[model samples]
Target: MDSVSPWLVILGMAVVTVSTRLIGYWVLGRYQLSSRTQSILEAVPASVLTAIIAPMVLATGLAETLAAIATLLIAWRLPTVVAIVCGVVVVVLMRNVF
Candidate 1:
């Protein structure tokens, strides 16, 4: 296999990503999904987050994990900007102290 240029790889990835999104949006626009499908779509963020965070928490242990969990909870309950700031602050503080 031939090695490719890093810039070419990045540009190809960007093009593929944009093309996929455009295709998805175009297709979804033409079809009306059922309520079940809509509900699943709504839950996608939470499901994805859980999938990502669960393993990280398990690998890292309680303190860091709890901080992340707390951050996520606070972020969900508070304003978007505040939530982001809080999560970042909590993670940074935990990393520095622990």
Candidate 2:
């Protein structure tokens, strides 16, 4: 078998991601979703976030766990973007310190 180039893999992934997004948008636009379904869909971002963060919190070292806690606290009152930025900052600082 031929070895795949890294650029080819990256481009393939980007193409697939964009295609799926466009297809999802088109499919969803054609339907009138009920309020309950809409509410469920609105929660997808949080669900995705939990899936991404739960592992780091559970399996990673002290810095990541501490950062997750700090992010959670910041998220409770501040905007999500701010919380995310602060989380990144906290993790970097904690890693450097410890």
Q: What's the TM-score of each model vs. the native?
A: 0.60, 0.65
**Candidate 2 Cα deviation (angstroms), residue 13:** 3.8
The residue ranges of model 1 lying beyond 4 angstroms of the native Cα positions read: 1-7, 72-84
Error of 2 at 60 (Å): 1.0
Error of 2 at 95 (Å): 2.8
Off by over 4 Å in 2: 1-14, 77-89, 96-98
Q: For candidate 1, what is the TM-score?
A: 0.60
The lDDT, on a scale of 0 to 1, for candidate 1 is 0.80
* Per-residue lDDT over 1-98 for candidate 1, one digit per residue giving the tens place of the 0 to 100 score: 37898999999999999998799679877888999988988898899888987877767865568677777798777887887777778777888887
lDDT of 2 by residue, 15-96 (tens): 9999988997898888999999899999999999989878899788899999989999999999999999999999999999
Whole-model lDDT values for every prediction:
0.80, 0.93
Best by lDDT: 2
